[model samples]
Target chain A: MDDTTARHTEKMRRIKAARDEMMKTKTEEKGLIIVNTGKGKGKSSAGFGMIMRCIAHQMPCAVVQFIKGARATGEATFLRERFVDECRLFVTGEGFTWETQDRDRDIAAAQNGWEIAKAQILDPDIQFVLLDEINIALRNDYLDIDEVVDFLLTQKPHMTHVCLTGRNAKPELIEAADLVTEMTLLKHPFRDGVKAQKGVEF
Target chain B: MDDTTARHTEKMRRIKAARDEMMKTKTEEKGLIIVNTGKGKGKSSAGFGMIMRCIAHQMPCAVVQFIKGARATGEATFLRERFVDECRLFVTGEGFTWETQDRDRDIAAAQNGWEIAKAQILDPDIQFVLLDEINIALRNDYLDIDEVVDFLLTQKPHMTHVCLTGRNAKPELIEAADLVTEMTLLKHPFRDGVKAQKGVEF
Candidate 1:
């Protein structure tokens, strides 16, 4: 080997050793409370992608969409058509809060979706559950924050991984979560008057 | 209808009218440059999810992994097994930079990956291209950011969407991108002594 290659090999050896040492301390494993939130795109998309990974692993998944109304997305269609046995999907929202304009109706829809979500979360048979846009309900006071957090922290199944996605995730939820990622918007073409594309956006 | 229902209906009608007016101004359709960056999880996961979206839309996709090495991921396995006809994945990364530890080898691998990426990006038949972990390559100076940005802006087809995902994305790429999202880490279980789970973390 050349001088550069020899130097690199030696450097890599040191890093690998250090990494291995740190990795040894990580031994705990349990179901995770994951949240995807913020004022950016791909929060829901990322959640759906993990569902695909779960499918690859032959894990059962249930998806509960709380705030987006009766709109079909590409991933939803694919999941419905191909992975019926693996995925259970529920779309339970009247519409966006601005479009719906009825607080009681919004609360009713959120509660209904939460009931289904809770069932899925408590089920040991299902390995993954995605609560898409349930945060909007919590943020709007349509769903009780304490009840949700209590169930997630204390009552949920031991092996059932759950993902909550939406903007404005509550501080309590973030604190309870094992993983929380906020998708921050840097720039969006919609601000430039570009229409949302079918596969890319919806 | 009751008084509350009537009022809610009227409010929704007015909001719908306003939304219809704004949506009329958005008529442009073109390929998008999307960037997912920052110090959080799911940037790569979101990109992979869009690839599933593309598959559902019956669009062709190409994915070039820039820094993940030969590691076998669940999504990559699913894509290869199920959507082989619709998706083409090239795992070109030698490994992570620190793991590789050779600047010249890193540059060579990145250049090789870019050549493959450029072919996939320039191809009109491929509707979506995902350059996974490419921002790492760009940030490390393994590839020319200007040349990459110029190609994406000027040479890409009109209807092909490209997603570049990793941390520390350059300013030029973000400015040139149609959509940019930074995955900010609110909390991570790994830091709290949880090992990376197989299907979830991989």
Candidate 2:
């Protein structure tokens, strides 16, 4: 081979070798759980980004949105309409508690959402299961944190990842999570008395 | 009823109506794909129960097993594996192509695995990208489909998922798929292959 050809071949070989090492490292990586809490917007959005990242890798995922009822935001609506069977999406509960102050009813709604979430979370097939707004529900007493934690711990080890989002995350939930993120509320449109805009908050 | 009880009752009634109207319809559900193609025995076994059925209730689905990776002894494995990700795993492609000669390597081996796969199929965030029994590197020319497909497409689309399993799935892949399955065929331990194992071959 000519000198130029030889030089190019060496460079290509080195690049391929480096890439091979990187691919091996990535394949060996394990799944994880992320908790996005604190008073702020985009906590769920951040979690959604992670979800997108996994999907890019063809990882099957499930999202169980707790305590978010009939108010169809942009994310829930798109997921519900587009995510298909590969990534399971469940939106349960009766909106926020303030909107529906019936403790008994809220608890029932929470239980219903939890029932679906329990099955998804325990399933080893799911790479990641997003329990959107779960942290807030636990703090508000809509769902029992003790039971939820117990269920999470008992799931089949490995092959299943979990993500929890929402505000007022209890200390216990944060402690149990693998990766905890606090989305501190700096400022939001709601502060200016403006309602949620389409495609942004939803 | 007391004033508070009456108010709570009315609130629940409203919530119920909203939930009823917001319930997702069957046609509105998203679709998923699960492939059980590989040279190993457990490709289907691992995939069937893991992801297919977990999202069954959340949405409708279909399964296409590209090839019968295993013989006839793994029926139970297939049956049990048909949990969360079942409906999506369809067995098509004609049992392990390596045993046949039609298998040709149209693509180059050195090229990244993700590059070729990205050239055609676009949705990497697909709920499940199950490419069963796809390892033909040793048997045929290395086309590197796995690397290409997994790299460009195997992304976690806003809750989408993907899973791949096989004996020879290349380590240096183009796609850093979210979930990957590697089915190992241990000692057959059978005496000269006495009539193949039942429920295990399919």
Best by TM-score: 1
DockQ, per model, reads 0.63, 0.03
Scored against the true structure, residue A178 in model 2 reaches a CA lDDT of: 54
lDDT of 2 at A170: 78
Sliding window of 10 residues with minimal summed lDDT for model 1 chain B: B69-78
Which docking band does candidate 2 fall into? incorrect
Question: Which candidate should be chosen as best, given lDDT against the real structure?
Answer: 1
- Best candidate, DockQ: 1
In the predicted model 1, the residue pairs found to clash are none
User: Candidate 1's residue-wise lDDT over A55-107, tens digit each?
Assistant: 88888899999988766778878887878898998889877877777778899
Worst 10 residues of 2 chain A by lDDT: A191-200
Expressed as tens digits, the lDDT of each residue in B70-141 for candidate 2 is 343233233235333433333334434333223332122212332323322344423434444444432233
